[model samples]
Target: MSKGNIGVTTENIFPIIKKFLYSDHEIFLRELVSNAVDASQKMKTLSSVGEFNGELGELKVSISIDEKAKTLTISDRGVGMTAEEIEKYINQIAFSGAEEFVDKYKDDANAIIGHFGLGFYSSFMVAKKVNIITQSHKDGAKAVKWTCDGSPEYTLEEVEKEDRGTDIVLHIDEENENFLQKAEITTLLNKYCKFLPVPVVFGNKTEWKDGKEEETAEENQINDVAPLWTRTPSELKDEDYNQFYKDLYPMSEDPIFNIHLNVDYPFNLTGVLYFPKIKNNVEVQKNKIQLYSNQVFITDSVENIVPEFLTLLHGVIDSPDIPLNVSRSYLQADGNVKKISNHITKKVADRLAEIFKADRADFEAKWDSLKLFIGYGMLTEEKFYDKAQKFSLFKNTDGKYFTFDEYKDIIKENQTDKDDQLVYLYTTNVEEQHSFIEAAKNKGYDVLVMDGQLDNHFVNHLEQKFEKSRFVRVDSDVAEKLIPKESTLESQLSAGDKDDLTSVFSAQVPNGDKMNFIVAFEAMGKDSSPAIITQQEFMRRMKEMSAMQGGGGMNFYGEMPDSYQLVVNENHPIVERILADKNEAVGKEADSLRSKIESLNGKRQELEKAKEGKKEEEIEQAQKDELADVDKKISELNTKKTEVLSKFSTDNKLVSQLIDLALLSNNMLKGEALTKFVKRSIDLI
Candidate 1:
């Protein structure tokens, strides 16, 4: 018998391993199971090289729990170390026996372990003492017993062992006595070794006998040995892939589509990423991707491994190439990780394109659920956008689908403005914007349904990507101004009449807002509605983004009362009738006021036009006095007109009804305004 200290230089190494080496103490299972897998792989290599001629019996690793004795043993039948090999491998710190073996069999080490090599020390994370009983396959070699008691020092002596294998026993630490529980051990095994290449046995299958559970002879193998992603695509059926998905996420809804990644070149990566049904709220369905290294689950927070938008995916990604520190929680931004990210993006895009090309009708059927994901990818990743443009679909109000070019061609003729910019009309809530959508549709124009959560951001992204293209909400403007292919309209009302209408509507409109509503008269057909509320694409987008970022500094527009344009279609029957019809007794009174307004307007216009050619200080005081008098006269006339309109408005329900209809169409006639409109609507019917 001989005893000596471990060959590590630092005495505080065990303490560091317990405290900071791993992001979580639970990683000890991954570290230990990985080491066992490493040992088994080494034996395979030795046998292939004709070094160990003994028959390699069952290579399954077994993890046994002896709660009565507070002992957890991990056993593997592999290249067990000889007495000499034990001295060099076990005694040395940071030097793994699997590393040397893998070096010799580099060609055969596909998923061979020893990448970290220091995984053995992880046992100290939970154990007060550890013991290893191992026998070499080599002839004339004796089995060795190596024991360590939570220290650098260890004892090694020849021991009687029945088989050529290794048994690792961990005496659970008093501080972490919870490891002695069967439920805890079962959970750790399920998380760590669920997809290891070699079969792993946990405990006996139990059945409820006599109202109590009893262990059966049949041991429960906790691992699948080979998962679906590890197999060739040709060898797998849809059920195999689906079953693997269920294994990964037992409670999630069936995935909308899946992208199978198998790459060996630039870097080795294999996994299945499923496109979940993002439904409506994409932000809520995140953090589902689980990253793995050599089948040992590392983490589900794979933001650095997968793109930010693709984090909505749920599945497994196993890549030995992803070099991890001891914790494996935080992945370093190395070349391999970058290569893997790029590879995954390419695979996802390729798979989507293939599915689209194979059966476009089926793809279209699934587009409502899949569109938000694709749109987000296109907006964030430039490369993803370039690939997605081929398959990214646009859904219209008529339940029709179009590709980028198809939609472009469909709207090029009538929807293009004078500047040759293509206008894409879209609706958010069909029910809320039904009037606007129907108005556009009535003109033989198609409207797109841009109601996804990301549509606000995606619409901004498309305007930047598509040349000479603009996306307009169906309610952004009146139907004619949306495309604006025609010239200006000739209004019968003069500029003064325009100002009178602007003041009346503007005063009645909502106020206390940074948003300003401009009232303009359009010579739309007589049947067109009396008023329309529209938003400028530029300012509204700024306000929408302001609500999301920076802060409420710009939130004046976000929080401020919504400013809507009370665009009175002057050519419409109601407005035209109001202008053409004499105000009866009110007409005579308005005419008398208008006569005074005309005389006052002449003096004000003359004074303003004269001052336009003169320098500011050069104008005489008498000219300023004349301008002030004109303004006073005009104020009196405007006051008189308001009194007349106020009296008419109280008596004329048409004015109130028209305003309510415009407000209702904009979905803004809320609270008392909504109640009054409802009552008035019933009364009118």
Candidate 2:
């Protein structure tokens, strides 16, 4: 027996490993299992090259948990270390200055493990003491037993072992006795080694017999030696891919499509990315893409490995190039990682384009499910946006799908405004905005269904990408003004009549604090609705985006009241009759006040013009007094005019009816207001 200290400059290596790596201490199982796999694979390689004459039978790694003894053991049948090899590989942790290394990276767990090769030493994180019994495959090699009790000191001695492999026994610490549980160990193995290259055995297979589960003689393997992603894409069928997806995510819906990536040039990368049917909630769909290093599962959170938008996809990405143990900061800064991300984005885009070109009908059939993911990618990654344009589709309200260029070409002749800008009309809700959609259709314009959760941001993105193009909601303006081809129609009402009409209609709008109604006259012909509510495109979009973003910088838009234009068609017969009836009821008094107000305004304007070039002292005190008097009389007359109009609007049911009709069309009239409208309609009938 030979006993010596681990060659480390500092004596606090074990405590440091336990303290700093406690957050990710669960990875100890992964590290040990991966080491066992490496040994098994090396044995296979040596035998293939005729370097070893021994039989490489049953290359498997088995995990056993002894709850009563509080020990977890991992045994492997592969090339193992002898006494001399153990001294060099396991005992000697060559640290130039251990104190300096710990000080620089004490806070970063991955940095410490990755900077120095600490795969074997990580067992100290969970185990109070660890023992390794290994036998080398070399002929006449003596088997060795190594023991360390969570310290730099260890003992190495020759031991009798029949098998040419290794057994790592971990005496789980008091605080980490959970590792001795069968369920806990199984879960850790399933998460870290489910797709490893070597078969991993946990315990015997079980059968539900005699009303309970009983162990069978067959060993239960927990990992697949060859997962679907490691095979050739041409050899796979649709059913095979689907089965694999079910295995990965048993509870999720079937994926829409998949892309098989196999690249070896710049870096070795192999994986299968599936386009899952994403819902409106983006947060729930993320973190489904599992990242692996040489089939050893590294993490499900692959945000650093893939673009933020691509995280919506679900699959397995295995690359030998990606370091298994490293900080996310390191992965994000690595040049090779950037290259891999770019390649993945390119491959995804190309695959989408291929699917679209091969079978457009099928692609169109799946557009509803695919649009959310495609829109996210286009909005985030510029390179993806450039490539996605070829296959990205625009779906119309009529359920017809068109490519960007195809839709642009079809609408360029008619949808282009007088400013030579293409106008893309869209509707958020097919039923709620049905009236607006029909009005747009009546004008020979096409409207898209932009109702996705990300459509608000995506619309802004499209505006920046497409030249001379704007997306307008169908309900944002009157159909004639949405894609204006001619000059706007002049209002037929006089200035006074317009004011009285606005006062009459604005008084009846519901929820004055929450909603703001701006009354304006538009000569949209007698066929148009008497009163229609329209929101400004830009303001509406800002509010929508603010609501989705949960209000940071855009919170200003969210806090403001909803503004809508109560567009009264001056050419409509109902509006003209309403004005005529109002004039008959209170026009005489309103006209007298207006005449007095106009005379006072003339006097006030003359006084203001007379003193335009004069200083305050130069102006006579009597002239300023007269100017003030004129302003007071004008203000009094305007107040009387407003009173007369308010009285007239209160008595007129037609005014309330028109305002309610517009509100009801916009789905804004509810509760008592709707009841009042129904009652008023019955009384008129």
Candidate 3:
């Protein structure tokens, strides 16, 4: 027996490893089992290449938990270390035995998981003491036992051991005695070693017999050795891929489609990414994409490895190119990761394009479920957006689907506005905005159903992508004004009548939470609705994006009240009648006030014109005084005119009914307001 200090830089290495090496202490099982797999694969490689002349026994990894003795042992039949090898590999710090073995057998070895020498020290995270009982497969090599407590000191001695393998025995600490349970050990094994190349047995298999589970003699191998992604795509059927997806997410709905990725040029990557039926809320379905390296599970939070939008996809992405730190808990920002992300984005776009080209009917059939994912990708990644536009579908209000180009071609002739800008009219809710949608359809304009939670941001993105194109909600403006092909009819209302209509409708607008209504007059033909509720596309989009992205100077818009435009069709019969009634109510009073206002404005204009081209001292004080007096008189007359209009508007039930009707059509009228509107509507009828 011999004792020596570990060849490490610091005496506190064990504490650092236990406290800071791994973010999750449970990852110790993954590290140890991965190392065991590496060793088993290396042995097979050496034997095949004639480096070792011996009978290749069954190479299996076993984990045994002894609760009474408080011991958890992991035994692997592999290239175990002899006394000399243990002295060199075990004592040395930061020097990985697997790395040296891989370098020697680089041509023939399977994928080696461990490059850092810290995997063995992970045992100290959950154990008070650890022992390694190992025997070399070399001829005349002595079996060695290495023991280390939770300190720098360790003992290595020659021991009379059994088979040519390694057994790592961890004396479970009182704080981590959960490792001594069969269920806990089984779970760890299943998570980390389920896809390992070698078989990993946790304990004896169980059979349901005599109305209870009984232990059987068969070994309970917890690993599949070859997951679906590890096999070639040609060998896999739809059922195989689906079964694998079910295995990954037991309770998730069937995926809309899948993309099998196999790339080896710049970086080695092989995995299956499934497009799950994502809900409208993108954030809720994130972190479902798991990342792996050479069949060992790394993390589900693959936000860094995949593009931000691809995180919504559910599946596995394994790449040896993804750089991991010592613990393999988090990924470092590497160019390779970015390359992989861009590659994945390309692959996903290509798969969608293929689907769209091969069977567009089928693709459109699944568009409702696939839209969120594709829209998210387009909104987030620039390259993805470029590729996704090819296959992206734009569904019209009539339940018809068209690709971006196809839809553009279909509407480019009619939907182009007076400015030659293509107007894409969309509605967020079909049922709620049914009137607006029908109104657009009546004008022979197509209205897209942009109802997804990300549609607001998506449309904003499309505006930038589509050349000279604008996306306006169907209810964002009146139907004729939405795609204005010709000069609209001038409002027949005089300035005073327009003012009266504005004051009347604006006064009756609902005073709901964070709602502001602006009254405007448009000559949208007599057949149009008397009043229509609409929101400004740009400001509404800013507020919507601000709410989604949640900060970065956009909070100002988000905090502001929702502003809506209450458009009164001046040519409509009801609006004309409302204006007539309002004029009748305030006609006499409005005339007297307008005459006085015009006299004051005429006097003030002459005085302002006299001072326009003069120097400050050249202007007379009497002229300034006169101008001030005239401005005060004009302001007073205007106030009196507003008072007459307000009085007439407040007394008119039709004004309130029109405003409520607009709100009801837009799904804004609710509760007491809706009830009041119904009562008023019946009374008017």
Candidate 4:
């Protein structure tokens, strides 16, 4: 027997290990179990290379809990350390046995998990004392028992006869007594050791016998030794992938498609990424991708490991290149991690292109659910955008799908404007914008459905990527102007006539505080609606994006009132009749006021032009007084003219009906205004 204090620079290392070595105290189980797995794998490697000539029977890692004794033991059938090996590896705090074994057997070792010697010290986190009983595979080697409390001191001595391997017995501390519970240990094993290369046995498998649970002869193996990600893609069937998905997430819906990643040259990376049917909310879908290192589950929040948008995917990513001690800053700075992320982005984009090329109809069928992911990627990752453009699709309001180039080809002839810009018409709500969509379709122009959660941002991205192109919502302008192929129609109404018409229509618009109506005349032909409402494309997009982004710098647009163009088609018969009726009712009064206002405005303009080059003091006082009087008289006449128009508009129910019809079409007429419109509509009928 021999006794000694652990070799260290300081005596405070154990306290740091107990308090801050790992973020979660439960991580101790993962570290210990992983060590056991490494030992079992080393034994297999030695036998495979003929280093060990003994019977290599049933290599497994077994975990057991003694509740009354308040102890848990993890045993393995693998390479065990001799007494001298224990003094060097265990007593020297930071010395790692697995690291040495891996360096020596780099070619044949099966997934050695421990790179940091600190994994063994993690046991001190939950245990008051730990004992190791190990027997090396070398012939005539004496078995040894090593004991250590939660300190630097330890004891090593010869032990009773036993099979070659190791047994790590942890005496649970009073504060962490929960580690001795069967259910608690079972859950920890399932989470951390569920996919270890060696089979992990917890206890005897149980079955119902005579309506009661009873232990069976078979041992309960908790892990799948060979997970789907570890195997070659050629060996897997669709059913096998699906079953693995179910095993990973029992309650989640089936995935739309999957990408199997396997690469070895620059850095080894292998895993399966599944494109799940993401919900409308991008936030709830994140943290679903589990990250692993050599089949050992590391974390679920892989935001640092993958690009931000790829967090929407679900499944597993295992890479030995990614270290177990993952800090956000480390992952961000690591060169290998960046390569892995870039590789994943390329793999996803290539897989999508392949699927689209293999079966376009099937791809189209799944586009509705797939666009959110693709759109998010395109908006956030430039590399992904470059690759995704080949497979990305545009869905029309007619339930038809087309690639970006294909849609451009279809619309180039008919939808290109006089400025040589291809206009991509789109609608957010099919039912609400039905009229606008129909108007566009009637003119042989196709409209896309840009209604996804990220469509607003994605449209902006596409504009930057697609040269000489723009996306215009169907309702952003009148059908005739949406994709202008010729010069705009000239309105025949005089400036004075337009002013009178503006007052008539603007007087009936609802909720001046929340909505602003800009009355304008457009010659949209006699077949068009007499009055149509449209919003400007730029302002509308800014406001939509502001709302989506929760209103940052673009909040200025969101805070402004909604401005709509109450476009009255000058060629429509109803508008012609309304103009005629307004002239008949208020023409005499309006004409007299306009003549007085025009004469006064001429005198005022002459005075303003005369004083243009002169300083304010140089201008004569009498001239200023006279100019002020002319402006006041002109303002009075304009007020009187506005009153006459207002009275005419109030008396004419046709004007109200036209304005309400425009509002109703835009889905903006709601609450009390909608109620009043319903009543007035019946009265007019």
Strongest candidate by lDDT: 4
Q: Which segments of candidate 1 are over 4 A away from where they belong?
A: 507-518, 548-557, 578-582, 585-647
State TM-scores per candidate: 0.91, 0.95, 0.94, 0.95
Task: Give per-candidate clash totals.
Answer: 1, 0, 0, 0
- Model 4 per-residue lDDT at 613: 89
Off by over 4 Å in 4: 208-214, 326-332
lDDT tens per residue, model 4, 524-604: 877889999999999888988889878999999999988889888887888878889989999878888888888898888
- Candidate ordering by lDDT (highest first): 4, 3, 2, 1
Compared with the true structure, all predictions reach lDDT values of: 0.81, 0.86, 0.87, 0.88
Q: Show the lowest summed lDDT stretch of 10 residues, model 2.
A: 106-115
Model 1 accuracy (lDDT, Cα): 0.81
Backbone clash pairs in model 3 (N, Cα, C under 3 Å; residues 3+ apart or in different chains), count: 0
Write down the RMSD of all candidates, one decimal each.
3.2, 4.7, 2.3, 2.1
lDDT of 2: 0.86
Q: Deviation in angstroms for 477 in model 3?
A: 1.7
Q: Write candidate 1's Cα lDDT for 1-685 as tens digits.
A: 8889888888887788777777677777777777788888777777777777889888878888887888888999987878788778777766766667667777876367556567777788888899989998889889999999877889999999998889999998888788878898899899878888888888789999999999999989998878888888888877887888887788877888787888889888888888887878776888888888888788888988888878978888988788777666788879777778887888899999999999999999999889888988998889999999999999998899999999999988988889988989998889988988988988878999988877888999999889999999888788877788775665667765565555445545554545466777777766667888887776676777677665467776576545556678877777755544324536677667878898888878888998987898999999999899889879988887877755655555556677778878877778997898789889879
